[model samples]
Target: MSARLGPGRTARTVIGVVIGGLFAIPIIAMVEFTLRDGDGHSLAHWAALFDPENARQYAPIWLGLGNSLVLAVVAIGIVLLLLAPTMILITLRFPRLRRAFEFVVLLPISIPAIVLVVGLAPIYLVIGRTFGTGIWSLAFAYGITVLPYAYRAIQGSIDATDVRTLAEAARSLGAGWGAVLTRVLAPNLRPGLLAAALISVAVVLGEFTIASLLGRQNLQTALVVVSKQDTYAAIIVSLLALVFAFVLLVVIRLAGRTQGSAPRTARRAATAPSARAESPSDPSDPSRKGNNT
Candidate 1:
């Protein structure tokens, strides 16, 4: 006989379905809107986005996509490079400052994007004056925006692992600090790093406030520009972006789950042979008889 779900499980399922439906309705509406035209349902708006013939018309979108891709890469790289080493060092050497580090990283979440833009304006102006208005310049601000997310992800991974023991083991094996970080710690933190990167990419892709206020033409800014002329196509693009972000989030969650299972599996495998070896010997068995003799 199959076991029935308890009231708690049933309630949770109901709540989850409700939440899913609530979130899904907007996407459904957007999809319907994208498919609908004056006469009937159509896909002209979606097709136009990808049609080579309309490249000239969609130049802003293509340019913005390219700019956003660059920004995402640069921003993710900056976040990982900056945070990984710092977090590792803090975990290894400055354990007392961990709380302070957490506070600093999370501080950005409290600061509104508009306020951040206001503060970054002068600094960006100086940067633009020195380096010109390259889109990559936005990566610095994007990195800052994603710091809280990246920090939490990385910190969680660090917390899950025995960093001190791992470092000491690596060191005893003649691994230097660089080798310890790059070869030992980094591999273990792959899930967190991937999660942090995906979050940063999503944040950069959807970011409008900072990029728009800074006069940078990112994906969202370009979508806004397109919306002025062709609202339907803009909606289609927005729906597509939403779907892409959803996929990334799903992947990050799966990665985290996979990472969580790995340590348990490894530990079980490592102990299984030893456990068998230590098991009580059967009295009638040859090994047991020989030991008794």
Candidate 2:
């Protein structure tokens, strides 16, 4: 079996390398492009980004980045707290409404971003008047935009997990609904939640159309604004943002893996002591009886 699978494994590795190379080439090209200067390649453009003298030039990018971060946090909180709990409720209680719920959650994606902006523009105008035109208000639109991806991630986890059984068991133990949802169901859903959150952040950061049309600045919009004048610096910042997102993903993946393994490790520890205790007290064992005698 090992011999048979060797060729297949090699093919998969080859395919993965080719796919990865396709992505890495553009990034490599971008880096090389950013380093070009008057005489030779230099970090001059990159260094200029942090120069106190030129801070004003980069201020818009920084402000946009800060706004994007705020949007990410609020959007993530909205999705996880609101969408996650709602999913669990619908799954456990309103199972028949699954299709309708999915239709509503996923409707945003079918509409073009520009079209969504058209509808959102007026709503945000009202919101701005009421809430005073903060960039954070953009998060509501982001939350709606991210629902499709977030819902898909979380719904898959719910399906794979025995949420009904888990909730019932918790309730039988005298836990309230809130306790059952948070303490019992949420942990089982962490992988999905993390994945959904990552997707949300990525979508929000890369977003341009809605933010542009809405007259709000985000990371992508800032990059576009900077690119017109200092293309090299904008490219550098873009690369950095991509690296940040990639690193965040890897860190979350590691954290999720660690969290996943913890329960199995704990279960093993719990069982091991019992197995050892039971072995010696097995009266049917002649060796044990002889030793006691």
Candidate 3:
């Protein structure tokens, strides 16, 4: 068996390496350029990113990072909190309504982010004039903007679970709908939520046109502004942001794995005891005689 599989496995490994190299080449070039000097062997560009005058010029770096993270986190939270329950409710209680809701929710994906920003700019202006350009307003926009990704993630998770069975089991135990959702449905959705949050964060972090058009001085917009003055430092700042995003992704994956594993362990524990209790005793047991008699 090992001999027969060798050729196929070797081919797959080769293909995987080729694909990985293709993706890595650009990233390698970017890092090299950012770290390289004009003559090709220095870290001067990276060094300049830390200079006092440079630091003042790049003050937007920390602020933009914070703004981006805040936007991503808040958008993800709102999307999860709003979408999870809505998806569960629709799938459980009003499944037929999903078609209509999906059509509407998906409209944002088809609409260019720039167009959406253009349309929403007036509304945000009105809101800012009244309530100020607060975090909540931006979060709300980000949440709506992210619906295409978040909704699909949530909907896919709901599709994976035995929603009807879980709901019925919970109801049989005298649990309310709230209890059923909180206990039975939400716990099983950690992976999907993490996936959605990651995608949403990626979208919001890289978003340029919307922030530019809306006149929001968020990270991407700030990055553009910095790039105009210091091309090399801008590249370095972007590389740092990319590193931060990678770390965040790794953390999310680890958390998802830990959370995903716990329930399966508990399920096995519950099932093992029940299975042992339900096993047949000796055939000579008196319970058999009761039926015969």
Q: Top model by TM-score, which number?
A: 1
Model 2 is weakest, by summed lDDT over 10 consecutive residues, at 284-293
Q: Model 3 over residues 1-293: C-alpha lDDT tens digits?
A: 68685668779799889999999997887798787766766888777878776678888866776787888888888877888778878887898898777767666655666677778988888998999875555777778777765665455455556778888998999999888877877777655666677867876787666667777767888888888988777788788777876775566445544544444422221221111122232222121111000
lDDT of each: 0.76, 0.76, 0.67
- What lDDT is reached at residue 31 by model 2? 95
Please report how far candidate 3 places residue 85 from its true position, in Å: 1.0
* TM-score-best of 1 and 2: 1
TM-score-superior candidate, 1 or 3: 1
Which portions of model 3 show Cα errors greater than 4 Å?
1-24, 38-40, 50-54, 243-293
lDDT of 2 by residue, 140-251 (tens): 9899877776775566557657889999999999999989988899888776677678867877887888899899999888999989989987998889988986776565
Candidate 1 overall Cα lDDT vs. reference? 0.76
Per-residue lDDT tens digits for candidate 1, residues 1-293, read: 23454457779799999999998899899999888867898887788778999888888888998999999999889878888889999988999997677668767766778889999999999999999999999999988877766765665566668889999999999999889988999898777777778878887888888999999999999999989988887888888898898888777767776774455322221221111122222122111111000
Off by over 4 Å in 2: 1-23, 250-293
TM-score for all models, in order of appearance? 0.84, 0.80, 0.74
